[model samples]
Target: MLDALGWGAVAAASLLVGAVLALLRTWRAGLIGGVLAFGAGALISSVSFELAQEGLRLGGPLPVAIGIAVGALAFFFANRAVDRIGGRKGGGAGGLPLAVGALLDGIPEQAVLGIGLASGEGVSVALLVAIFVSNLPESIGSASDMRANGKGRGVVLGLWAAVAVVCALATLGGYALASVAGGQVRAGIDAFAAGALLVMLIDSMVPEAHDKAGNRAGLVTVIGFAVAAALSNLT
Candidate 1:
């Protein structure tokens, strides 16, 4: 209801602000890296607690294990596509593919957050904050890639708006369903989100860090996970 709308607005606004900040020439790279780190933390926290616990609650041990495996596979293929496109020879037009994929990925994620937030105010707020914060890197990265591809500002904004609409619809639907079915249903949705996020973290985020920072990147990656885990426990 109103709560869901507020959370959605918060998520979208945070992402938009992050995108603007990320496009600034002087601070873009640093901000992107920092946001990526936060994204890592978010994926780790969501997977470890929300998703895993939800699986166990709804479908016992087997479903949880299966969900993890399936999630890993999903992440693997999605990144593979991104890598393939990214590796193509000069002027590969990164924006379209990324925008499309992001829209697809974002739908379920928003839904998970919407449902999770419905459970308890504190839990939902914390989850929403993590998701909102994590999305900054992605929004910024999208804007930068579009700019590099020579897309006009209007095009970039249009693409962003389109994806945002998809997310809003998906989240609204997920929230409605979760609200009807209550706890067990919410857990299932959380598991799906957790698994998907985990896949994205391992396949994309870690590799990007390694490419950027070389050997020492692993240290940063670990630090990111630790910070997120600690914060999740506090919640």
Candidate 2:
């Protein structure tokens, strides 16, 4: 449990790191977009190579399919609702949606991390690096947008710090679940996370990257994918 909590905190620390970077400097749109694109690609690879593959191996197809469908729909509707509730306005503007989306993305990933820890197969370096790398651009972009919209540094930092804590708790929850749950349940959780992540990338990250980075975003995305794949293979 302690090990799981520590690893979870390590993964979640990127959120604070990214927030600090955003608050400390003014990042160019192109740079931010490029980073977002890269992160998206890495996350895609993580979902495919790590989450989905393990889910298939452990749970078979049906549970994985059901989990994916449910997860995707849940995130889609919830994200829309957040948008409808004025998540895109005022000083907080982009911060609200971004924070919610990040939470949606983070919880499942960290949960799976905890599961891995409890499984005794040890940690997957590929997954850890992917989660950490992907989280960075998300926080940076969100923080930058919030600052641009006149949100105070304290508010932005506080939001990310809170998110990190929640994510750590989520990892601990996954660790706890692992002791009582069977293979299918774990597989379902992994698939569910993959589904949410896929929707998030398509709905926000990819489009945002393209809008800001133009065609160059495509190349960076591919590069990120390649790097992540290499890591997955090597690790």
Candidate 3:
């Protein structure tokens, strides 16, 4: 449990880094869009190679399918709700979707980390790097957006902090679940994260990137995907 908490915190600590960067810096539109595009690519790579593949291998198609459906629907509805809220507020909802995405996917991702630890793989440095690397642009883009929307530094920081803490605890939850959860349940959890992240990329990250960075976002996304895919297979 302690190990799970520690590792989870280390993984999610990037949220704080992003928050600080957004708070301190004035990001150019091109740069922030590029970062978001890169982030979308990284997440796509994660879904393809890490979560979906692992889920299929762990259990089978059914649980993975179900998990994916549930995750996608969950994110879609949640995003819609957030949009409505932001609409009522008369704007100021730029980075909120990613923050919601982090919260949604973070739990399952950290849980997978716990499962890995419990299975005695010690830790996959490749996985660690993937998680750490992928999280950076996510936080940076999200924080930057929130800041642009006139969100207070304290509010944005606190939100990310809360997300990090929740995800850290989810590591412990996953570790605990490993003792009792079957392969299918584990598979479901993995797919759930993948599914949620996939929807988030399509709905928010990709559009933001293209709108902000123009055609350059496409190549940047491919580069980010290639980099993350290489890292994913390194182990």
Candidates in order: C-alpha RMSD to true structure: 3.6, 1.8, 1.0
Ranking according to TM-score, highest score first? 3, 2, 1
- Clashing residue pair totals per candidate (backbone < 3 A): 0, 0, 0
How far out, in Å, is residue 89 in model 2? 4.5
Query: In angstroms, how far off is 197's CA in candidate 1?
Result: 2.3
Model 2 per-residue lDDT tens digits across residues 1-235: 9999999999999999999999999989899899889988888888888779988998899878988897788779877876776544532346455566678778877888888789896887766777777788889888988888787999999999999999988899989988886879878887887888888888878888898899999999999888887887774
What stretches of model 2 exceed 4 Å from their correct place? Answer: 87-95
What is the Cα-based lDDT of residue 99 in candidate 2?
A: 67
lDDT of 3 by residue, 10-40 (tens): 8888877877887887999999889888878
Instruction: Let me know the TM-score candidate 2 reaches against the reference structure.
Output: 0.93
Which one is best on TM-score?
A: 3
Ranking by lDDT: 3, 2, 1
- Return whichever of 1 and 2 wins on lDDT: 2
Where is model 1 more than 4 Å wrong at Cα? 26-31, 69-105, 116-123, 179-184
Find the number of clashing residue pairs for candidate 2.
0
